[model samples]
Target: MAPTAFLLVFSEPGPNVPEDEYNDWYDNEHIPLRVNTPAFLNWTRWKAVDGEKPTYGASYDLESYEATKKAPYTTLAETRSDREKGILANIQLLDRRHYELIEPHPIPLRHSTTRRNLPHTSSLSPEEDFNKWYHEEHIPLLAKAPGWVRSRRFILKDCGQMGVEAQKDQKPPKYMAVHEWASMDSFKSPEYKAALATPWTEKVFANVVAKERRVMTFVRKWARL
Candidate 1:
């Protein structure tokens, strides 16, 4: 299979960590170890433009949602070098979530250099209406916006604790919508606003229990060799 699931990692270097060293470790050691696995397809990283604290986002394509719990992937932590462990200790992890694709676009997404990440949870019981509204009305209108490339929706399958010691049992929102853009300008365009301003959009959003909006800009991408 060509990666039907992904792992979303949110983190940032701690105040005491040097930016140069942190980036070097991430670019050289941290990402490479995971991408080297056969089940880990590709890795793409982004930085938040919304001025949020845990300012980094990384998405790792996986063979399946179960891939993270299996051999090589699960064993990587035990194989980490002392330096890698030291660097990771000083990093502040925000959230680590695993999601399986639920909305498959007619046009496949080749690459997304710029995008908006909307992770949310619904308050509606059964969530049938919420899912219906998103698939039927919401995405169609957003597709009308200029510079639209593709959209993807995923449902959370699991959550990882990482450095989140306080909320050991806490979980993130269950649904994530990743909207690809040709450029950031598309987000502020009139069509985009029109799509979001619709009555249906307002109605569905009213039932959203939790949500986080992140405007992401590309940092780098790597794939298995």
Candidate 2:
């Protein structure tokens, strides 16, 4: 179960915080603490150019659902330092979701196959049509394009049982689609564009909300458990 599931967090710093300081806190403190915890595998952060408000994002992979829910990641009231609180107060949380890897299942993801993270929420009621469209049509066709390594769809989990939920009352991101790429330019290819513009896709977008695409790159690396 090594690195079987992941937690996705999207955020934006408050108007008062400087970009440099926010990044410093993550690179210097936040990431290290999480990485040191048991069952954590890798962590990444990103900036979303075409995404929702407060366009920063991060994800952490864990050994299993249990490891994913373990205390090191779950309980938080007992674990905040002033530095942590200072950072929290200066940021706005956009969305948080937990997804168990559904694409490259039972197999470890190739390191760095994930270059850009495109996360979106579907507005289609019952949440099934949207997922069916993604898993059955959109992703299946899109994954064939050049540079596309793996595409994963994660559904929101009962995080109330996990350590600490970032936002207690807000509605969680119902669905998340993560497409790993070999290079940033792959997204601009004609095949990729064609894959996105279909009659079916139009119907899908009509029912989508907070629909966004983000530009993400490797920020740092850490030791794995």
Candidate 3:
């Protein structure tokens, strides 16, 4: 089977609209429209933790680049256009990124991970804290989890704003960390649980990370190149 790719979209609530309303619009209209698209495989949504303002995330999976590229125009261009007109019409666009799945070793699993833009904050000490914890601690821990598979990270240089304007008082982080898990169940394994429960996790997160948002979903293939 061809590996799945993920399209991640990140954004903050608009100036005049309320977060709840935006979320409702997404759940009721946007998601349905995307799923209804011809090549769309699966979708999911998540909210950011520690975010100064509400942060929303969505994930879309397609069989292959060819399928992904062709599906929207063939199946749901009209629906997508309508959705863009409503929810995304006036909202401040934050970030968008495309990710290709990492090939798993030993196991036949396929998955990809990507990070949208991240906001900057004075309290966020990326050099001494975030980077250290992520590289030294978090990555290693996840690697040790059950069904451990190949993983990769990417930094989106020109993705867009990441809710920084909502909190004008703080500076946004220059980088975002993206992690790929072989399977959702693997991430939920006992080893993973213990890793996150450790003091190291607490120490790493202490005062550095204000919020985090994540979403997971299954993928389907429409066309392959």
Give the candidate number with the greatest TM-score.
1
Using lDDT as the measure, name the better of candidate 1 and candidate 3: 1
Per-candidate clashes come to 0, 3, 10
Q: lDDT, candidate 2, residue 38?
A: 76
Candidate 1, residues 37-101, lDDT tens digits: the string is: 87788888888877875788888878887777889888997898998777666666647888898
Error of 3 at 123 (Å): 20
Q: lDDT (CA) for every model shown?
A: 0.74, 0.65, 0.52
Q: Which stretches of model 1 miss by more than 4 angstroms?
A: 107-126, 164-166
Task: For model 1, state the Cα shift of residue 42 in Å.
Answer: 1.1
Report the number of backbone clashes for model 2: 3
Worst 10 residues of 3 by lDDT: 114-123
Sort order, TM-score high to low: 1, 2, 3
TM-score of each: 0.88, 0.75, 0.50
Lowest summed lDDT over 10 consecutive residues: which window, candidate 2?
158-167
Model 1 poorest ten-residue lDDT run = 117-126
**lDDT sort, best first:** 1, 2, 3
lDDT of 1 at 7: 84
Candidate no. 1 TM-score: 0.88
